[model samples]
Target chain A: MATTAVAAPSARVKAKQSKRFKIWIGFLFLLLIAGGYFIVERLVQGLPVTNLSSITPWGAWIAFYIFFVGLSAGSFLLSTLIYVFGMMEYERIGRMALFTAIVCMIVALTFVLMDLGRPERMLNAIIYWNVTSPLAWEVHFYLVYIALLTTELYIAMREDLVRLAGTASLKGKVAKWLTFKNSTITESTKKRDHKWMKILGTIGIPLAILGVHGGTGTIFAVVQARPSWNTGLFPVIFVVSAMVSGTALLLAMYIIKKKATKQKIDHGMVVSLAKMMVGFLFIDLGLQFYEYLVGVYGLEHHHLEGLGTMMGSAYSWSFWGVQMFLGAAIPIFLVFNKKTGTNVNALLTAAILIVIGIIGVRFNIVVPAQIVPLFEGLPAGDYFPTFNEWMVSVGIAAMGLLIYTFGEQLLPIEEIQSSEKTEG
Target chain B: MLSNMLGSKNMTEKDWNNLLDTALPDVEKEMDASPFDTKLSFNMADDARKVINENLNIKDFHKKYHSKLLKEFGEEVGQDFASGADEPAQETDGVKWGMVIDLRKCVGCDTCTVSCKAENRTPPGISYNVVLEQEIGDFPNVAKVNLPRPCMQCEKPSCVQVCPTRATYKLKNGIVTIDNDRCIGCRYCIVACPYGARSFDFGESYEDEMPGYNDVTSPEYGIERGERKPGKTPIGTVRKCNFCLHRLERGEEPACVETCVGDARFFGDLNDPNSTVSKLSKSPRAFRLKSDLGNGPNVIYLK
Candidate 1:
């Protein structure tokens, strides 16, 4: 396996690279057309163009927002395992994890901007800081976190960028511009980058867990009006599930990207990553179980109604079908079963299932809590995302995928095979 | 000017002091000419020390000096102090705003709804208040309850808590206000409100039904925000009942409370125990909607 480092990125990498470029371009064109339609509709009719109403104030946009945030937090946490904790076995995915984190954050913020009633006044959230509001705190945390992630990412790639700066390709040009003229790869510079990466990763661990995603969860959980969301454990579940989704997404992306480029898969690392993903999933499931159990045991009418709306109502398919079956059952089976557990294809399927299932989890979190009437006499909300809302969400997600695809094509995200051996 | 008067006063220590001081000899002439005994006057002066300098209650001071002051200053001055000190029993003033609604007085005709819309000139889908009609019990025995829902304007408003921009907050006067200029219109406040009191102004209007519906924006919070237009302040913002703050500024009651033909709405300061709302709030029949939520809503209802 150590000798395999000498092979380099062979003919397989080159062939797959050209095809992925074409796929990326086609996807981008489709996203542009879809985006153009929704943009015009949104401009003309405002928010009424979607199914959103005064009752269901948050919908697909919010779900997508949390989804992307989970991805970002998950990927960043994985990157932390390598940089901060010095987990050498998982080091191959470190920079790639950072890159994915950055892309996911971009996508998440875009969803929020699209969802705003006054997108033009989005800056007002920053201009007027409301210390009491969790959303306000989230806005500030996001800005600071983004800057840290970018700086850390730049440092992580500095050596590679310096090396690539001399090449002839467009990526080489980007590297040249990014590195500046006086760039040098020295032992001291490596030490400096390594030290900074540790510091940033250390800071980011808490910021991501407590500030970014947990605060995002708090934005909902703090609302006493929504009984389902008003729990101390809610934000904890949010962070844990974020780890679940993040690990699944990164693992899925790593394998899919390698396979598409015909690069050799790191079998041991994938198995370990899969194990970590399932472990996080089990923990997330335990938290969710307790959350549901407590809600059921309380038997408070509103809590019961909310739980019923999630588990047994017309919309329960999202629970049983997507959230439970696809998100948990199928992925758990694929990972644990003796026959399919080791196969790369089966693990990939499990990874994709987990990603889709998490979307179900996010939807269930938001919609079920809201569908139950807040008061006895008030009408229960009946909501489904309108076509425009679904299309807009799809378009945005496709746009994110396109960017990630193109980014992988240009960046040196794939690791230079490490030569160090543990021969006894 | 008073040196001649001091000369007439009998003094032991005073006499020695007066001899060294620059004063006329007849300073106490009127006091010496008094028919009352000098020893009596000296004894009375000593007692006046206890009354004036010591810890004497003013009532006791009046009781002790009543006869003496009356004999000396006559009836008019003493009587003047008595009435002046206790003029009028304390009465609080100013507009302590309040409202009274009789559930027995209400027919649930929805007149308040029409009046509120007309007064506020609200755009389409934005109702400040509404009467929710629900039937209770079975078939022949069913009874209809016409519950009119308005902004609770809770002392602990959920809308205020979840507002990301501090766009919405509660005023000391018991009114909840939203600064449309500051509202990012995330509608999180709307969702968080248990009362279902909030509405998002999706920039819709009755332009097809009415010619000038979009031609004017309501002057909320006393600011004449001018014409309703796309991307305007209130157009893409959250709105709800403010007890008609603009109308309240004009010394008028809220249009819903005023125009309820059934007269079932009550409004006023819950702070003043003597206020109509305060008195009504204490009634055994008076209870808040969802009192268990701990929102401490200002609005109270009579069953």
Candidate 2:
């Protein structure tokens, strides 16, 4: 399989980017090595190596878990807009979104696994399926969602993969193996793939909303013990915040990749995406305001205490400074202000800020509510992730990035067929 | 005046007997007409008096009837009949288990907390039950209240509601139970419980200094998970008070109730109005933890 592909000299030619590619590979290798060290340390010492306690049972790991789940849900939702709803304007990102959704889910589930006390028994969740548990349902949902994402992604990339299979480059060789030797690209196949994508993406929308992200929120909201998290509106807020982070991530990734590759930036698309990102942010903030207002107005001691911890306590900086000021305020202003709104650089900044801000948002959601104890005498938790926990998180994230980079390099993720046909 | 409207004085033993006889006529008739069991029933009725009066081993009565009843009915003969190993599975009456903790009687001695640990042999980070003591009001106006908290064992348990795998569930009888083997140790149930009744077993233990702490025994869900080893059945799972169901199965109260120095905790069937727990549950001072949340907590407290 490896040799036959290397023997071919086809119409597709390679460009000389070896030196730059080698340097990038070196950097990624360094990250992987460093990350591997921390991952090992965490495994050996157990969760005690992290600063987590019973009070703040979840900290950065749980925050990161929800963040990635949001990314998966958001990307899948965006893909639905393209492939399912037939939004032709957004066709370019369809396959990429599906792939991103799948990868993000892997990352999310990995974070959950890392956070567990017994990682070896992870399969217990599947082996003993408890239908009543939302977490159990999520485990099943994730497996199904990943399967759907994989099938949808394969279909979305099929034609491009078939086109690449005929070329002589390493990527082409990889693409050839991806498609069975007898697999042909035909009009009917295209139509069939399109029909399936629409069906899967359509089905995926509710599954992403109700089963994945909202269910993630239900994991928190249903805990009537935590007053800050115990509200009907909480899950809705989670869905909205997911959109905020997801759109920002895709927008940032698209712009950064296009700039890096010296490809033409779709200014109109960039502006529209930024507007959509901010639009979700506003709705997210509005929902949060009402949520906070209701919590504050009720004067329930625990609820107030939770809100206080988020807004006025030591970690309030994360809520006000990171979540609101950096994540919401700056991005909203940059996207809406006359001088910055249309500028691509400014929009990119806002998108990046929103992405980072959503991290703060996720952290605030998990930590502060826990900071306020269930009952008064039960010690209030004090937690911030240790250096080891932070490093392991970074390492896991780098591992995900490496997977994405290698995936893009090997697969026909880009819309090459459409571009070539349009050129003709 | 309000008591006069619902006074028990107007009711007699005959009236109570008639009420029971009418409510459960079939069982009563079975009792009256069992020719093969006539002498035994009459003796049981007589011994039931001495057993209540002289405190005879109820286990003896159960042993005497265990075989005969199995031959005739293929099952146990009483409502609260949790017998030999197989009996819990054949619980035909569908007991909705509940616990009533009288806070007014609690002295905050942490006996329930210690007994729970001793009974469950919980690891360092996990306590299936704990007593939460808090002081209300300011300096001069303050009252030191000892609130011994066990799981509320809610009828609509939030932990059960949000559990993705349904590893935790509300039993037919009100007890909320966890299937530890199935749990992912995700601690979702711990997070979701309103009572904070649940705890995650982080696998830390007293085995390093305390000999045999890790050697043997974790009688969880009535299955003895031998050895307190790390990475075992309950090590990563979520755990909470099951009203000491294993002990309850042995016709005993929960460890917390049994060990409470103040005699504050009462364990019984809330379904039985004549049970000490039910009558105590109706006292004017009766209250529940977080009553406003409407979890319908089976654990009632006397203020």
Lowest-sum lDDT 10-residue window in model 1 chain A: A415-424
lDDT tens digits, residues B28-134, model 2?
Answer: 56777765566566676887887777577666666565665666555545434444435454345555566677776788889889988898787787777777777
**What range of 10 consecutive residues in model 2 chain A has the weakest lDDT sum?**
A1-10
- Kindly report, for each predicted structure in the order presented, the TM-score of its chain A compared with the true chain A: 0.95, 0.94
iRMS value of model 1? 1.2
What is the per-residue lDDT of model 1 for residues B1-303, given as tens digits with 9 covering 90 to 100?
257756776557876676656554552565688765455466567777776776665455556556665665679865643433443432333334444455556677989888888878888888888877778899999988877777888878888887888899987677889998888888889888989899898888888899988777778888898888887778788998888998888777899988777668877766666677889878888878888889987777888
Superposed on all Cα atoms, model 1 deviates from the true structure by an RMSD in Å of 14.0
- Name the DockQ score for candidate 1: 0.46
Q: What clash count goes with each model?
A: 16, 18
* lDDT (10s digit) by residue, model 2, range A306-410: 999999999999999999999999999999999999999999999999999999999999999988888877878899999888887887787787788888888
For candidate 1, give fnat to 2 decimals.
0.66
After TM-score superposition, the amount by which residue B91's alpha carbon in candidate 2 deviates from its true location, in angstroms, is 7.5
